[model samples]
Target: MAVFRESNAAPYLQPVPPVVGDAKVGGAAPHELSIGEIIRRERRLSQEQIEQILQYQREKGVRFGEAAVALGLASQQDVLFALSQQFNYFYAPDAKRGYSNELVAATQPFSHQAESFRAIRTQLMMRVFSQDDVRRAIAIVSPDSGDGKTFFAANLAVVLSQLGGRTLVVDADLRGPRLHELFGIESSSGLSGILSGRAETSVIKQVPDLPSLYVLPVGVTPPNPVELVERPAFALLMRELLSKFDHVVVDTPAAVYGADATVIAARCGAALVLARQGRSKVSRLQDLVATLNNSPAKLAGVILNEY
Candidate 1:
């Protein structure tokens, strides 16, 4: 709910003086400090103020940073800046930095758009990952093309990677793969090569700037995408990737691709439905959901992409 001006300046800077409590003495570096410590150092909240927030957190079972914001000891921006510093997240207000401008997570870390993605990530973490019966691999699906599934998947992966989790975005949309273009990486050999056993090495490509994020592009669009995905090798590959990565997000072709998305989702064991505003038809979406219901994958949730 905090609005930040569009600027290239560093989002987090050293605090000038105390507003609530005594200044913090020499301690850990800003980046090395924990969330509570960072808030204490940056906001100069007194030890009593920090203790009060901690007590509130313990009673309400909420985070220390959230308790601080609720008590008006620090603003949301203050806590988020501290979080970014703690996680070493990069914030780029300018979008003309080679990566797609549409990727708000990479281009505008503090923007509302990126915040929305983070919210989605949190929901998925609780709903999918926190469960006793949780699924690691997730398939992002849509009823048709141009519904922003690929865009959402890419940004979601970036935001998840920002959590310091080892995240992998696999381009399973063989008919028209775009992640390679989104990440500006070569698609010379990838999923297809791995499936066909033509490429000996894994084609997982790491984003140059984002060390935690990796991508598996759809290489050399094969004539039979559904066949390639249906093979047992594809399932094995997914299992292997899941064992190595903290989160595996697969961007699949639309439902129109003759069960390609359904197959991938079933293999992944979880699916996120993406519907574009004004562009996606409700009837078609219902049909796609019905199809997914029959598969092994659980319907995680539907995302209405406004952009």
Candidate 2:
């Protein structure tokens, strides 16, 4: 019984209900991602807002596309392109992963939300990313099926790279993984591989564009992920990854899926709790906090998500 979501987050004002996918890709666990249409709908502005967009372009020399991007009014890709154009920036996409320069662009929709999330992430990294603590500081966000934990991990890793640190985002969600999707790469080697001994340590992919940010996708979801995460090889991989990267951010399985996150906590130090404001339920938050309490990781703090 696999669950799937067809699209990512749409703008709060224009949300399309999530579509559940019955088919599992290669029989991997079920998951969801906002489709292109859903993302585009996020930027659909009212007629008044449209007029303002046009006026801003006419008066400020900012085109509708550019202005929309700056406002975080579009999808992640759109924002990346828009911002890149606005700022006169360039970044080489990862050749291996087909990393897009579009990732560097910023849109009004993402830009607004990123400002708040970036500060929190930056502050957290600053606090915990010491030489001794980098191995222990894992940012295990709350169960945000769509509020951008993978996106945060990818961009946050870049911010760390800018600070001259080698970072890796280990995608631990074997049942439902999408870390590779963010980098536009293949998720064929990840926590599952190390456990199965199918991938050597060198298999960890250095994501394009975000040079300092490396990655390990959940890889084709394993039939039984619980045993895989509990393996000693997984722990060894985490330790070795820490040795290689100055900072290692394990994007553990979402909070709703209990044991996987607990396994992540057993090996990592702190956790970053993420819960959306209007979309998340108080019960879900309660369930998340309660689950983490049973894990070995220390509670760093909660990061309430903003849509």
Candidate 3:
């Protein structure tokens, strides 16, 4: 596999010349790049090396990747990375890219846990994202802290962004903000600042690696967290975000904190309740569902966080 360089290096594929027949020079378009071209560009293979691999591939009667591996020119990981690029599927095969490991959808995109997130994304797309009855934004609420609400929201946003749409994850949990840390973005100005009229559109940060994903941190964590979320500005902000982004994932404080989660869910117009396998109590989950049901927000569904 290629070495992981600077965290801020542009990860997207650049345009190159078209491939010429058996030469395998390059692809007609950036996305249409053949496997050989992709591997050559990614691994910086010389023209002579490319010819060697091509000769070996023809003699072995195997695919370019298999032939490269057989010749010890590229590893299986390198082939996988090139394939991801060909399909425009984004993920960091190396940890030094600087995102938190909690973002399994970006770090371990092929893992079972990340696949589960994709499954959830598919369900949400059908139920909430496709329907006109609900807004594009969905707030993530859990019965208690440590129920993996933030983790779920972050990873779900990553998977949603992988669909080639603009997706934004909002850190609405002003009381104990963590999305900025998880995403490794600046938290100096975010929802709290926007709600307070102290900041504007600049607070929204575009996440690296994942081109279509963005994050709105909690910013200054104002003294009155509840007041900030309860204000009319918060609802307006959500509407604006929904208009701009294809999908929005809001992360709220735990239900144990107060009415913040409920209020955020209402503002977002949809809520997905998360409960841990052993930690979340049945009564609290019931109560949270009941509260969300009373509000205008549609209940997307409840998920048990066993991971």
Candidate 4:
């Protein structure tokens, strides 16, 4: 059951219904917090306000969230946040923590754009990461920079993690790494440190909001990214990571940079090429496709990044 949603409309001005799919993803385990408790905590509602909301809920015969909204005690976003807490479906409606707005999947899980990422995630899960499949990593490559490769890889990893599986995104782009910045974590020691054997400390960091999502940033940018990726250590690292993680997404240097992407894709054994709608040149896209087609990696798909 692959989900494909394309409506990138603006977020709702009023609370409608939570987007469907919570059940198929997985039933929420029983949580200890009530919606009212969650809203009170997040909104800093007073004891009197809580009593008012309870009385209103009983009198109006509505749910706690609807009653709160009606009484103007909490905003629609507040109710959504409370619901997320009760359901174990995590998102940062206030952008207070979790992930930055750049990670639409985490900040706006019910939005159309976020749903589209879930659609892509469903496809990848079915094709490349089935329960029986041996290969688990997919390298995201684009013909050139600004093709939304890192953005796509980051969001895709978020949605994959939403399925409750441990997912990791590797910043293989040692040349110009940005996944750490996108994820809003420190890049003090990451993939480069591990591959170069200079890492004396733990390089992988779990995303604060997403317990299932982890990142391996490019620690200290080396003078030779190409040489670093070409070593046997990189492939061995990918294999080891694949064994440990349910899903792995490798962000690579653009094809125009050098053979880094191709080599990385071959090592990961799967690649998803990205092409920007208006900016990407057809010939360059074709050349990248051809180059990847010659490699050992399976060409999973080419996504036309409209965002």
Candidate 5:
């Protein structure tokens, strides 16, 4: 006989913790050198310094870079640059550089991180575009904030556009909009403006140097983001974007907070969930997936963002 246990917990009202797992979005080629070796070869640390860091790493069970930083042998920035080189990911030393420098895919196409995004793009092409029945708009969502949904959407758009596909990344996360900052554009007019009937055009700004890529920021924060998202205008806006652009990527707020992600995903008919490694929790991710499964959008496979 099966024993039954009483359930007394309330539903999770807050944004759920992200689910962490192996990186599934991009497939990276194998590298011959390790991080420590790369750092040594880059001259960030001498042979003797490497020996000291290794001794510390074994004793403390910490990473080589961590040991180096602790010993005051290398700056955090130097370690990061070396790691980027080791993993073939992009790293810009200067923060004041323009938008191109800010975009990893644009600045370092050869980097493994950029290649992973390209792999995701290929997967999406087959998942979302291979079928002739669905619309082109794809919504990207996360279990909680700071999971890198905006970063994924922006870089994915850039990579997709690089292939000559006309792509548009929409900042649908009205509560904490960031596409404007990512693309280095003004947010004076965007989705909020369009929904409020304040802006006539959905094309807020075109990404410089990438004629095929465009960005639609959250123009002005609205008091009721869920209400705005549920409006007919939002659907109309999506349709218009799909008709005009070859690929439309919409960035939504965290699934744990409000119903905005559900509304947007339902309207778009397709969605991709992102979760960062180490930070996301398994239980929370399962709950978020259950909620998403109830929506109209076809759930694309989960992406484990390792960066």
Candidate 6:
């Protein structure tokens, strides 16, 4: 596919012209950026710092997004969104609202968690910070819940919101939907609420700070979550979401429990499987990876939770 360089890109987001290795397009991949490496790349991410970087890149004609992609933080293509359709991760509550600074506070230390999160958020600011399409993914898994899927999801969504991506966290997990709990919102009225045609759109809660990350908390538990997940209505919802927001992220159940994870994966552009530090089973996740290979959605990869 022909890669369309961002028309207004400050030149810094483009690939360095000539690269080495499968993950490169310009000079020898700028050396795999480690956690420490990236933090150094950014002197600071404040508006002034960002402006200075953008100004310097604009003057030098550097491609910031490409640079980030070369490091595996950004995709050269709209692969994230395209993959979502290719796999069928088409379930969603709605397009998230506008992003806010408050969201960032909710999800502190995002850089300390997933290295990808740090870089992606930075690159997203290059072209589309205040839009949902920019940051539309949230990886939610449990090291038995207390380990913090909802915490992470809520925070991740918040991060995206701060970075100008209208985000949303869907309680697709009928088993234990607790995003509302994390945000101190109402849980009795979300996906299930709208799916079963019980409540109006008003039922959906607007998470604070994360006003950009809307919350369609898990509605009434269904008898057959698998069936609900497979319904055409669910698929349509996802497409509609893409049209409405800059980004939409759903908080799904674990891979071990039900088909919900697979269903959620099918609708999103990609998937991030999270496992806890000690409680999570390596062998089981390996099996889960194998399971994702056969799933309708594409497996972005696993996120081994260190904390």
- Which model scores highest in lDDT? 3
Better of 4 and 5 by lDDT: 4
Instruction: Give the Cα lDDT of each candidate.
Output: 0.78, 0.56, 0.80, 0.79, 0.72, 0.50
Per-residue lDDT for 45-164 in model 3, tens only? 998888889899889898999988888888898789778866777667777778889988898898989888888888888888997755658999998999988899999999998887
lDDT of 1 at 234: 82
Candidate 2 residue-wise lDDT at 279 = 72
Error of 3 at 270 (Å): 0.4
Tens-place lDDT per residue, model 2, 1-307, is 0001011111111211111132222342122322322223335566666666567667879756665555555544654533432232323322333553323321222454435545655566555664343457475666646655666565556555544456667787676677777677766555676577665444467654344456767776788887877777666666666665677777766766666776776777666666666776778777777777777766666665554
Against the true structure, candidate 1 reaches a TM-score of: 0.72
The regions of model 6 sitting more than 4 angstroms off are 1-147
Sort every candidate by TM-score, greatest first.
Answer: 4, 3, 1, 5, 2, 6
Tens-digit per-residue lDDT, 138-241, candidate 4: 99999999998888889899888777667789999988999998878988887877777776676777786566788889989898998888888887787778
TM values, all candidates? 0.72, 0.62, 0.85, 0.87, 0.68, 0.56
Q: Least accurate stretch of 10 residues (summed lDDT) in model 4?
A: 5-14
Best by TM-score: 4
Worst 10 residues of 6 by lDDT: 1-10
Model 6 per-residue lDDT tens digits across residues 137-240: 43354324455455556655655654444456667777777666656676655676555555454544655423345676776777777676666666666665
Per-residue lDDT value at 300 in model 1 = 86
Residue 17 lDDT (model 5): 20
Better of 1 and 4 by TM-score: 4
